[model samples]
Target: MEQNILDKANEWLTPTFDQDTQDRIKNMLAHAPKELEESFYKNLEFGTGGMRGIMGVGTNRINKYTLGKNTQGLSDYLKKSFPNETLKVVIAYDCRHNSDTLAKVVADVFSANGIHVYLFSEMRPTPELSFALKHLNCHAGIVLTASHNPPEYNGYKVYWQDGGQLVPPQDGEIIERIESLKYEDIQFQANENLIEYIDAAIDAAFAKSTIENCSFNTPTLAKENLKIVYTSLHGTSIKAIPGVLAQAGYTDVNIVKEQETPNGDFPTVKSPNPEEPEALTMALALADNIEADIVIGTDPDSDRLGVAVRDTHGKMILLNGNQTMVIMTAFLLEQWKRAGKIDGKQFIGSTIVSTPMMLELASAYDVECKVGLTGFKWIAKFIKDFPELKFIGGGEESFGFMVGDAVRDKDAVGACLLVCEIAAQAKASGSTLYQELINLYVDHGFYKEHLISLTKKGMDGLKEIDQMMINLRENPVSEIDGQRVVCIEDYKNSTAKNMFTGEITPISIPKSNVLIYYLEDGSKICARPSGTEPKIKFYFSVNAPLNRAEDFETVSQELDVKIKNIIAAMQLN
Candidate 1:
């Protein structure tokens, strides 16, 4: 172990820390030196969104001290930002182990600093915290969740008054303030008078907004006809989704009781993440047994959703984030056009790594499609920046979608409603969701996307991931599967270079550690590291013209093979 790591661990053994934390440090010092080093090697800083990590007794972990420090800094910053007002903030947590305790600790720190807190009485979806922040007219909000990460992991995400995660200057300023504070500086004493427990009323209001915003021209009979199988995957979505669906008149819904309970361990699945198909096995099986039209599963925090629909062969198939987003955005656009709302002043949002089909759809409707960096914070920022434009909806390729900007984040609750509306309307029109997707491809083009993540854990793993990016940057790939690399966009340096012409242009977006390559054949490959995890992700997207719906499977297979060939050629496997 390094001397600095040991020194940091020793500082946690002081009188400032609790006895249990001190005992754990002592045990690590006596018996688990490697674990100690891994736990204390570095402090868990806020990433593009917020702080997330494994839970334990170290600076690098999610615990009382680290979260306390964040809350203290945020409290000070909030006070400074709103000096003349009575500062108020709301806090919510998911069904993760230790989340409720950590949430109380955060509320205590904020209340100790003379800030009023509206803490949730029990576990709630993360998006509700965003909604409640603005609904309650609070200045900031915090939610204790690690999204789809394992039970051992937890996180703290800070939302501003706009209900979006901290972005740009605020993110950097809060990070600086957090770094300036020591563990001893965190105020843990609770001001009972300043802390209030909140529930029920907020849930009703959020469900109302979700229903109103996501519902379109779908008939009442259509909603009744759509049979759905839904699962919370042992997370917090159960607290809102079931009620929302019933209230929206979708009474033919089946809940996977095996996974409905809010267990932090996520006992029903290997991982609580909906993006993984295995996590939705129970719901899929239920859908099959019930002969349902659709299956929807939300992650622990209820921010990302995984969806499945019966294909042409009547086999249940999972749709990737891009597929879902394309379908949802197209549906929203068509509805808007029918309502005479798309007057060339409306726009939808997407990330750079998302499928290019979104742009095609936007062009078809004569609306703008703004692409931002990874993270929905940028999409939320779009609503703030371009107030003149009507913000329809937006999403990234991480199984996340935001509907109508009601909540300035990826909201699976509202997205779930939107998905059901699409499915319900399709069924009522004598079309299936899968057929609608194929029809969209016939109208636009067939686009397929694949994502692969390489996890590298521990301190050495971090260095290896960084070195991989470094190597890629130094020696860019000039070709992939015999296709010429026409352009390369380096977001880190904010530049896009044309390989053949040697022309360079500035990319007018916030700088991030991401790289993208565009091929002459219209293939795009993006390499980005996860902002919240120890994994690096590579996104591959390929598209082809679909003249008719009958050729959908053949063209889709071709694109899949093209993506696989690109992946193999790049040696990413």
Candidate 2:
């Protein structure tokens, strides 16, 4: 065992820690040397978003001690940032195990530090937390949710006064404060007078704002006829989505009973992420049995949404995140145009890794589209930067969509309502949502996207991921699947190099460890390592013109073959 790790473990056995944590550490020290080393070798990093890891009794894990330290650091920063002001913050948690307990710890630390806290009375969706922060005019906010990770994982996410995750200087500053904290510096006691519990009033306001943001007016006869099915996947959406959907006038809706209740174990699914097919299994099954018009499922925090709609053959087909974004963007733009709300001052946002079809859609409506880094915090920053323009909606290819600017983060509740409204409009116009998707492809060019994620676990895995990025940059690929590589965009260095011209231009975005290769055939390949998880992700996008809707199947198959060829050429599969 490393001496440093043993020394760190020894400190936990002192009276500063609880008897239960001390006992667990003593047992691991006696018999589980490897586990002890893994737990104490290094501190769990508080990244730009915040900290996430396996829950356990160590500095390298998500536990009371780490959480308390983080809260104390945040409290100190808040005081420094807003000196002499009554510092206020809001807190929420999901269904993950220890989420409520961790939330209490966070609140206790803040209150103990003479900061005011507005904590949710029970579990709530993360987006609602964002809404509460902005509504109450708080200085900062915290939400405890691992967000679709395995059951053993838990996390903490920080938001600023803007109700978005920390960005640039703020993220770095908070991280610096957190790193300076010691276990002994964390205050674990609570001043009950400084803590207030928030409940129904906030929920009502959030639901009202969501309903008002819908482009379509109240439930029309068409919308009333739209049949829908939804599942929360044993997460926080169950507390909010159904109520919002009903308020939006969808009369016919079915809930997947098995996955409706909030459970940290996510009893009915292998993973709680709506992006994966397995997480939506029960919802899709319910949709098929009831022949519902569409199926919607949300992750643990209800910030992301996954959708399934019937294809041309009347078989249920899950739409990828890119496809969902395309459909939503198109529908939103069309609605805005119909309402004469688009006067060139409105815009939409997407990530660099998401499909370029969003840009085309925005252009069609004469609206500008802003591309940001992978996280929604960047999207929220765009909103802050361009206060003169209206932010209609934005999304990424990871099944996260935000319909309006009411909630700074990606919101599945509002997105769900908007999706149902689009479906109703489609059915009223003598078409299905799937057909509308094909129509969008025909209008804009057909764009297909695929994602490949490789997980590398533990300390060695971190080294390997770094080395993969280094190797790619050191010896870049010049060709892929018989196509010439025309451009290389290295986000880490904030440069876009034109291969043909050998000219490099600055990319106006925050530095992130990501690389993109543009092919001569108008295809784009992006490689990025997950900031919150132990994995690296590669995103591929290919496009072709669709002259007619009848050729949808043939064109889709051809695009699939092209993507497969590209993947094989890159040896990703």
Candidate 3:
């Protein structure tokens, strides 16, 4: 069996794979049986998120073989989904390693299979692909992006006829078709004439929808410079962001020069996640030097966004994902109300683990806010299900936010443009965006969320994780860090238990292995195992209304201390 694996690996040692990938595979085969099995295990299954893995020349990696197989699966699924169909599928790629080549391979596979392919002439943002999927009314779509993952990874996201990620039975059906064939079964070429280049048409559609989605109807905030700083994080938003801001009439736009050029390796940041302050280090430095009013950064795919603002001390302060979502949603809701954009039937959505203040804020304004399972796909599902009811926006604590219904997926480029617009609008109102956020804290109460990931690698690691979950279920904790757990939501069992009455209620949302403990003090702790990575994540949320601005740091310190104590008590380092 080992020899068979080696032989299979050796076969890909051909000229099809680049020398670097070929050499890496050769090196992996020489010494690491454990690594080899992990690398080749059953081919990284492509589901709704499509495909993702560390880039390499293995059946398990996101190389040409995997990318081609996925495209073939999509082609087969598309044909079955729309029989007698002249299918059109739009394709886009990000700035991750092998993203462009993998996208071309996907285009080739689809076009070669007799599907009309609309390929981006160059690299584009992930949300633009989503917009193209809808604009062209494509039968399907594919975006080659690992999202906010580290440098070693890349991904392929499959969009369905509804311009959303494949969900439910369709997701399973596509996976089955992809598994039915080997690498050799994939089609990788096409009549080039059938593959049309799609650039200006889709770009125009995206820009038009984006501008239309801007809620700055009154433009009361345009009189000020706003002094905004934004970085693409060497991803896909370099050109369109500045262009959108310039078009939005903001003259004081500053871009981070060192990280201006798109590079897959992401030389500047250790990781390209805006949720982490370290990722925005360069942008913050630039903002301080330029004394910009606000700073924002996007990930490799530009679907998620991060922002920073100056504190009263005149120092750049990074906002967490919760803070970013809260501000955006609040700002949009206010603008919509002022412009009478609401029909009272309009709604928004957010994940369950996101800051709860959004649901309250939406309710206060007569806007419907529903909680869905994690991932933008679920949020998109809501958007597709309710065509009559408008979807104003949706976001998660993981730094994903999408505004308007222009695109089903998260749109960082759109959000980036809107953030600057919000800043300008606020400056015109004779206040800063930070002051607006503080006002929100005063209105909806303050919230701070902390995420802790514990990685467990290897097959044995999976078992250990399962055992941990089982233990947590069977021997449930009554308290953590001396705080009573008033309620426990077990997503695996789909039940919410009330500690006082011993009553159990079903969770209407999707069933997952996530558990949320709602404390009496309104703080929440959520434990969820990652579906893609070898890790379990714990989300800690704590907040206390500040009596005065002078006591903000004191309250923040208390929350941090509470989180540290809880983690320490749980023995989760």
Candidate 4:
């Protein structure tokens, strides 16, 4: 058994992994040897996002050793990319297990290499990290977080000089540098002189910037009579969310006690995601009891917002991500237009998988709407790609999103602040948020969307996922729920074709492993593999005009049923 495992370790210990890593592998083999093979069978590859895995002592796991290797590669690329330049980088961590330790490890490596480091003294929101990168003029940034993933998981996210996730040539270059390093060669020593803990200055800057953009018209909006409920879903948002609201003059904010504190396990919610209504159950119930005006939630890192508003029947109904994005975008555009804030060159970005209602609204309002591959990084890329255009806001169908470009990433903090401002705007007009949504739908046509994810895990399951993508690419489904395919947009192939008219066009977006089918009846189906998880997702979107407000309930219920029926018909369930 020892011999067999030794052969396995030798198979993977290429020159890039170094002597210390190989010695550790050998030492483990000498004791609990078979396990060592499992640990070092492969070096964790740098994914589209940064490194993420279960924490353990393995080349494939997320530990100090693995993180050091990743940081070393990133540092090398930073030096090459900014040679002869004064390079500064910001580092931050969430409340996940070992998040702070991993963040410090990253700081150590960069500081040891003589790069300036502005490290967060404690765990903070992901967006604040992005904000620091830009506010301090850092060339790069790193945040230790797995976002809403489960307790055992942790991750590394790299950012560019623009405060957005790295993109294209830079991302590829960093990956190359990381791939070139051996574990032993990573600069792991601390250079305390070059690394400074940043808390007060950045906190002040972030809060000041947020307050300066405060949109609420009156301090009276925060009166005790107007009860507001909030939850962090056991993530980092709780720390600053209340302070932010309080600073905004919202004194009546009630916290969901169970989820107020940051915990990596995300003890209260089964899944720490704000997109799912189930995750908001505790906060929703609390809001109902207090007759709250609104309920808001943020994911683990506090970059995305989940909102619940009083419906027509006065029930606290939660809005799905699509519905939430539509409301927020319409409100921002409307507010900007009414205030004459639109300079005619501003733009908003969203993923291709997000609801197209925003696209329609943007066109109607004469604002440019840009669609990128699914991820905030692409949104940031769009911001960087066009320096002249002001990126007002961006979001995805996932609960993760951003309301401003200040941080260059999805900011749950900014989202929370904006939602309060939006709520204030609604209250000032004598309409609840639900009513405001209906107003948008009444002016713009009604659109409803839903998503389904099929999880396929483990080694065999991983293979099956790959095969599923191949199968779909090979055998395209021409119809779903009896609607004939009108157009097929194969993002992988970078082509869009008319199934009937045979009209061909190029998709200007970057190539991704996504397939979208548009039906003759205007229904749409999209197939995409989860970038961060082992799941295949199918998104269905359907639209119908709402002739009257009374029909809102009936239409919404029907749309929900239609979405499920279509999913069943497609056998994605």
Each prediction's TM-score versus the true structure: 0.99, 0.98, 0.93, 0.93
Candidate with more favorable, higher lDDT: 1 or 3:
1
Off by over 4 Å in 1: none
Which regions of candidate 3 fall more than 4 Å away from where they truly are?
1-28, 46-49, 218-224, 457-464, 547-551
User: In lDDT terms, how accurate is model 2?
Assistant: 0.91
Angstrom error of the Cα, residue 103, model 1: value is: 0.5
TM-score between candidate 2 and the true structure: 0.98
The local distance difference test score of each candidate is: 0.93, 0.91, 0.81, 0.81
Best by TM-score: 1
Taking all chains together, the TM-score of candidate 4 against the true structure is 0.93
Regions more than 4 Å wrong, model 4: 1-43, 46-48, 214-219, 222-225
Better of 2 and 4 by TM-score: 2
By TM-score, the candidates rank as 1, 2, 4, 3
For model 4, give the 10-residue run with minimal summed lDDT.
216-225
User: Which digits, one per residue and each the tens of the lDDT, describe model 2 over residues 1-573?
Assistant: 889999999999988899999999999989998889879988888653467899999988899999998898889899899998999999999999999999999999999999999999999999999999999999999999988889999999999999998888887888799898888899988999999999999999999998898648634798788889999999999999989987777888899999888999988888888888888888888888888889999999999999999999998888999999889888888888988899999999999999999999988999999999998999999999899999999899999998878899999988998888888888888899999999999999999999999999777788899999999999998899999999999999999999999999999888999999999999999999888888999999999999999999999999999999999999999
Tens digits of per-residue lDDT, candidate 1, 323-407, equal 9999999999998999998888999999999999999999999999999988888999999889899899989899999988779
Q: Write the per-residue lDDT of candidate 4 for residues 418-479, one digit (tens) a residue.
A: 77777776777687888988877877878889888888864455678889889988887777
Best by lDDT: 1
Model 2: C-alpha RMSD to truth?
1.3
lDDT of 3 by residue, 144-235 (tens): 88887778889888888778887777888888988897767788867687788888777777877887786375363472467777888999
